[model samples]
Target: MSGSFGGQSAGGAKKARIEIIPLIDVIFFLLATFVLFTLSLDKIQSVPVDLPQATPAARPITEDDLVVLQISEPGTAYWNRELISSTEIPRRLLDYKATVPAPRVLVSGDDKARYGDAVLALDEVRKAGITVSIETAFRATGR
Candidate 1:
């Protein structure tokens, strides 16, 4: 039998080999899929609507037209220097908007004031459709 156990020819067994082309193709396919998925994450989903066109106003606004809305430490709201209750904010804003051609508000709060009060004032100002700005002064709190 010449040491052939199965009575077959003496051809050696084929060595195991990794096919590089198919491996590379699979890796490139996964990379392309991952890149496309990541790119899609940045898309914003929103409802499309037709917006109104803005017409430029002939008159320009001045510093005197600026309104200051201040919130104090006790959560009290002051409009330009006058103390006003929270319920009065919306009405006052609407009245001011009606009277001024271009309405703008400056929202400020005391260093220790309740943040909710300031946010409420800002929300009312926004509901009134007026432009608003926040005060950014740094004051040292005497601890």
Candidate 2:
């Protein structure tokens, strides 16, 4: 039973078409959001400078004492006498801290090294839940 119009044909409903304009807009918005977020992360940039001098009493660093972290030339770093990438520092420190009885860290940076690298190392170590202390060499005073 159908309409008796001039030439009427009856069939099922038509399929809906996807609108690409809105999809493109959404993709663009996501791209913009990601770009903005990445740009904002630069605010965490580290400062480069020689730390102030302090007169510290002679304290012996026993074998079980502070763990050493060194930043050497050519962008190489060492943790506890092991060579590891900078990104791996935090995870390694966490693992080390879990096993060590007294977990302490000392960051010693080369004077010729980039200060940002040193700060980043320190930040990672601190985030790993270990106490951090920076090493400063004190020159002998003339009598």
Candidate 3:
């Protein structure tokens, strides 16, 4: 009766076996749940713009023929993430209009930005002579 060292259960050789079916089932369940949870979510892609809210209406019709013009609070302007002088916008828009047909433009001005700065950006767009849409956030009213 060697206590535990040589003690063998009355059954034959006890081989340590790792059961993996339960682990696989749990992994699959978690993966499936995560995918299903995010499947119904709408993707809202945009540059960070602290835009003033307005009535829910038409949104920017983003497409391949689109140019995003952003004006920051410091009066700095960007063209699709590329820093560009406000003076450069007109030239660039003219160049694009020459190569492309009917390019759409979206102008986004920060809420804290100077009113003159927003007007200046819009003015540049106007000078370019391309149809421009002012981008704004949707403020829901009465639920």
Order of candidates by lDDT, top first? 1, 2, 3
For each candidate in the order shown, give its overall lDDT on alpha carbons.
0.79, 0.73, 0.72
Per-residue lDDT of candidate 1, residues 8-127 (tens digit): 445645545788999999999999999999988977799999999988867877876888888765536778778777688899899999998888998887676688888888898999
> Per-residue lDDT of 1-143 in model 3, one digit per residue for the tens?
43334434545455566899999999999999999989978999979979887666365444667887777656367687777766677788898788767777878765545678778778877887888899786312111
List the candidate 2 regions with Cα displacement exceeding 4 Å. Answer: 1-61, 138-143
* Per-model C-alpha RMSD: 8.2, 20.5, 15.5
TM-score, one value per model: 0.53, 0.48, 0.48
Better by lDDT, candidate 2 or 1? 1
Candidate 1 colliding pairs: none
Which candidate would rank higher by lDDT, 1 or 3? Answer: 1
What is the alpha-carbon RMSD of candidate 3 to the true structure? 15.5
Q: What is the lDDT of residue 111 in candidate 3?
A: 54
lDDT of model 3, residue 84: 71
List ranges where model 3 is wrong by over 4 Å.
1-62, 138-143
Write one digit per residue (lDDT tens) for candidate 2, span 51-76: 88976645655667677787655456
